[model samples]
Target: MKFLLVEDNLDLANAVTSRMLMDGHVVDHAEKIEDAKLFSDTGEYDLILLDIMLPDGDGRSFLEHHRAKKRDTPVIVLTARSQVSDRISLLDLGADDYMTKPFDHAELQARVRAVLRRNHGSSQPVISVGDVSFDPVAGQMRVKGTPVKLRNRELRLFELLINAPNQIFSKQKLCDRLFTFDEDVSENAIEVYIGRLRKHLEPSSVTITTHRGLGYKLDPR
Candidate 1:
């Protein structure tokens, strides 16, 4: 899954990004409200972790504007405010969930999953493509009831393909979702990752097929 993190504190942002990276999720970080808006405008994010106090302005206004535009992307507010009224106001402003600062990474991740599950209306988050089953929250895959070990990059590629089994994903689109803002991705990065993911899915009935001029899709054979 791809996430947009609106945070200004370098240390905190790095810690959170690192933790989520370990779970095989792509995270994009923005330090200011303007940059946050730019990221939101250009791409579709699975979820956004927004800090209440940004360098440019209050994120509440951003949330208000985002909701006003009918953008239903789930937002989890990160704030230092602990007052009940503050929490209530944030919720009223269209935050899906709010987490006070100085938070435990585990709890924060749990809340993120819970919010995503609620947003997608799934109680048990499991996605399937043929005999391959993936738990999005845990970032784990199982083939025929047996767990398969995958490198993070391979797992990320498979996750994208499995989530939209029949839909074609262009190389550019995959690169956008797979790499972050600062990474130096080679021209053949997407192709290489796709090749790696195909080998991992060999034991399962699912196969990723190229669409010639279009791109690629996961085909269940």
Candidate 2:
């Protein structure tokens, strides 16, 4: 998953970003509401981790403006406030969830998964496509219950494809989801990852189909 982490605290941001990366997520960090707005407008993120206390402006106003635009992207607020009223106010403003500071990393990850699962309308933690199964939390893939060793990029590509089986994903979209803002990635890189994934999945019942001029789709073989 791709995430936009709007946090001004350098230590906290780095800690959360590192953990998210370890969990197989691409993250963009912004220190101010202005920077967060820019990143939100320019990139596609599965979720937003917003901090209420930003250097330039509070995240409450940001959430208000974002919701006013009718953007339905899920937002999980990171706040130091412990008051129920504060959390309620943020939720009313459009935050999907809130994590008070001094939170458990495991709990935060679980909340993230729960929110994502709710957003995707899936109750299962492991998404399976034919004989291929993927555990997003563990960042593990299995084919016919046997572990499938894949490169990091391959795993990410497979996860994206399997999560939305049969949905056509354009090369550009895949590139955007797989690479970070500073990474120099091209459409050819996407193809390379796809090719590698195809080879790994050849023995399984799932296959990736090229849509010619369109892009690619994952389907049952």
Candidate 3:
């Protein structure tokens, strides 16, 4: 998962970023609201770890601005503000979760995972489609309880397909959603990954079919 962390406390920022990185997440940090806004405008992150007290502005205001644009990206407010009213207001303003200062590191990590899972429409740590079961956190796949080795891109493509099961994802849309915004890749890369994933999964009845001129759809039967 990719996270954009907006916190002005440099020491806290470094600690959070380092911990998340060690836990295998890609993290980007911003010290001010302006930089956070810019990052949000341009990046596709799974979650935004926002601090209500920033150098430039209140994070609540920033969340309001982001919501105005109809961006549904989940946010977890990490702040020293522990007021019940503050938490209520932030949630009312659309924050997915909130964590107070001096939080337990394990709790923070679990909340991040829980929020991401909820955003994906599930709380199950492993998603199953037909004979395939995928563990998003561990990045592991099992077919009929047998471990199946998959390349990184292949796993991501398969995960998207499995999550939506039977829905069509256009090649361009798949490309846009599968990779990070800054990655210099193309829709053809998506096609290649799909093709590779098909070779491994199709025979197992988790078929990825082309809609031709439209895009690809995965049918787990």
The lDDT of each candidate is 0.88, 0.88, 0.82
Q: Residues 47-121, candidate 2, lDDT per residue (tens digit)? A: 999999988878998898788878899999999999999999998898999999989888888899888878877
Superposition-based RMSD of candidate 1 using all C-alpha atoms, in angstroms:
1.4
Cα RMSDs, all models? 1.4, 2.1, 3.7
Q: Which digits, one per residue and each the tens of the lDDT, describe model 3 over residues 35-102?
A: 88888897667789999988787998889988998999999999898889989999999999999998
Please report the candidate that would top TM-score against the real structure. Answer: 1
- Model 2 poorest ten-residue lDDT run: 116-125
lDDT of 2: 0.88
TM-score of candidate 3 against the unseen true structure: 0.72
- The alpha-carbon root-mean-square deviation between model 3 and the true structure, to one decimal in Å, is 3.7
Residue 128 displacement in candidate 3 (angstroms): 3.3
Q: Whole-model lDDT for model 1 versus the true structure?
A: 0.88
TM-scores of the candidates in the order shown: 0.94, 0.88, 0.72
Colliding residue pairs in candidate 1: none
lDDT of 1 by residue, 90-148 (tens): 99988999999889999998998899889877877899877889987777889887999
